[model samples]
Target: MVVGYWRLAGITSGLACAAGALQAQLLVRAALGARHTSTLVHDSIITPFVLRPALAPALAVTAATPLDERWTAQVTLDFSTSTLERHDADGTTTGLGRVSTLAFTVGLRRPLGAGFAAGAGVGGLKYLPAGETGIFRSGAGGVLGLAGAVVSYAPPRVGGRWQLGIEARYDVHRFITPALRSEGFTSARTVHRIALALRAGRGGAAGAAGAAGAAP
Candidate 1:
C-alpha cells in the first residue's frame, strides 16, 4: 500500500506539473495579445450509481471547480448503501452490509479546446467504513487516502452560458476494511455527468456597480 501510494503521488505530480506549465505558457501568450482566447471557469456536481447482477444500488455526489482554462479543483462526497453478498457452496447467503466514504481531491483539468478536455488529478479519500448493521461507524475501515485521475470533454461556449461535458476517472484506494487494512485496494471508478447554468452577475459587475477605484 505504501508503495502504491508513492507511485501514484509521483505520477500525479509529474503529470500535473508538465500539463500546468504548458497551459500556463499558452495562457500567458494569449494574455499578451499574441492570440485571442476565451477561458472558462465553472463548477458542477457528480452523481454516481451502481446496478449489477447481485449487488444493491448505490449513489455518490461530487463538487468540482475550474482552476483555469485547463485546470480544476474538486471535492467529492461519496455515500452508498450497497453491500456485497456471497453465496456459500451449501446455499448459504451472507451480506457484507453497506459502505460509504467522503473524499477530498485537488486535481488539474486540461482542456483540449474545441469542446474537449483531458487531465489528471490526485487526492485523498476520507471516510468511515461501516461495521455494524444500519448504523454509521467511523472506524469500519473501508477506503482511506486514495489517488485518482480524470479525462474530460465538454461543449465549447463563447459567453459562459450553457455547456455539456463528459468525464471519466480512475481511482486507486482501499476497498474492504476491518479484516484487511493493507491501505485499501485499488478500484477504478468511472463517471458520466452533465451541467447547466446561467451567468447573471460577477465580481466585475459588482465592482462596476459599486464604483470602486473609479476614475472621476
Candidate 2:
C-alpha cells in the first residue's frame, strides 16, 4: 500500500509538470451517480465464487486539459462502496460483507458530436474491506491495474462559465486477496456507473492561445 501511494504521487507530479509546460486549459468536473459491481473468483478444488451484484453510490472528480481542438487529456478519481453477500449451493445467503474501492485513471477524450464526447484510459485501483467479517474477512488490501471508458454529453454554454452534462462510465480490474490466494483463488471485478456533472473551464482555439500566452 505504501509503495502504491508513492507510485501514484510520482505519476501525479509528472502530470502536473507536463500540464504546466503545455499551458493546457484547466477544467474541473464533478459527478455523482450509481455504480453496479460484481466479482468472479476462480478457485482450485471447488466451483467459482461469484458475488451477488452490488449496487452503490459512486462519485468522481476530474481534471482535464485540451491537447487540441478535437482531443483532450484528463485524469479522474472515482470512489464507491457496497455490501456483498455470499450464497450457498442452494442459493441461500451464507454471509454478508462490505467492500469499497478507489480508482484513478488518465485518459484521452475526443469529441463525438457538438455536445458529446468519448474517452478511454488506464490507471490503478485499490480495494478495501469495510466492516467485513466472516468468510470474506481478509485484512489484505491491494492495488491493481484498471482500465475504463467514458461517454459524456455537455449542453452548449448555458450563459455562464459552467456547463452541465451527463456521463456514463465503465471500469474493469482484477481483485485478489491474501485469503483468496491462500485458498488458491483469483477474482475479476467490473463496475458500471452513470452520473450528472458540472464542467467549468475553457478550451478550443481562443482558450489555447490565451493559455499559451500566459505560460512562462
Candidate 3:
C-alpha cells in the first residue's frame, strides 16, 4: 500500500510540473515601419530650434513571454533613419543631414480586450550620423536613453498558424546632435510610428481557447 501511494504521488507531481510548463507562452513578431519625429533643439549659440514633422523608416523585432493571461514581459529591438533640415532667417535651407538610431527596450504588456494590447518600455539608444551637409555636421556618435509605448491589434486567426496585426508606437529619446553639439546644445526628440506584421508562436492555452471561441 505504501508503494502504491508513493507511485500515485509521483504521478501527481509530474502532472503538476507539466501543467506549470504549459502555462507559460512565447510570442514572436517582426515588423517594418515608418515614424514621424518632432525634435526640439537647445543650443548655447542657436538658442532654441524646432525640427518638426520629419519622417523616417524603421524596422523592429519583438519577443514576449507570458507572465499570465493578463500580462507579459516583452523585449524589442528597433532601428531607424531620421533626416532633418535647418533653415536660415531668410527661409533658405542651411543644413540637411540624416541620423540613424538603434535602440533596445524591455517592458510589460497587457491585453485590452477585443484583440488589442498595450505596453510600455524603457531602454538605451545609439545614434550614428549617416550624412551631413550645409550647416549640419556629423557629430561623434554616442549612446542615450529611450522610452516608449505600444498598442497593437491582432485580427482573428483564419485557419492559419500565424496571426496578423497592426501596431503603433510612440518614443522619446534625448541626444546631442552633431550640429547642436557644434553650437553647444542638446535635444530631445519624440517619434510616432506604425507597422503591420505577422505574429507567430504560442500563448497561454486559455488565451488560445478564448480566442478560438471568439472567432467568427
Q: Which candidate is the best by TM-score?
A: 2
Which digits, one per residue and each the tens of the lDDT, describe model 2 over residues 91-135? 566436776778899998877766677889999987666654543
Better of 1 and 3 by lDDT: 3
RMSD of each: 18.5, 10.6, 6.2
lDDT of 3: 0.63
Q: What lDDT does model 2 reach?
A: 0.65
lDDT for each residue of candidate 1 in 1-216, tens digit (9 for 90 to 100): 999999999999999998765443321000000111111111122532221113222232333444433454445433333443444444555554544444555555455555444545555654343555322232544445556654444444433422233444445553333322233323322222111211121221222212211100
Report how far residue 76 has shifted in candidate 3, in Å: 0.4
lDDT of model 2, residue 127: 69
What is the descending TM-score order? 2, 3, 1
Full ranking by lDDT = 2, 3, 1
Mind sharing the TM-score for model 1?
0.44
lDDT of model 1 at residue 198? Answer: 18
**In model 3, how large is the Cα lDDT of residue 49?**
43
Q: Count clashes in each candidate, considering only residues at least 3 apart in sequence or on different chains.
A: 4, 0, 0
Residue 119 alpha-carbon offset, candidate 2, angstroms: 0.6
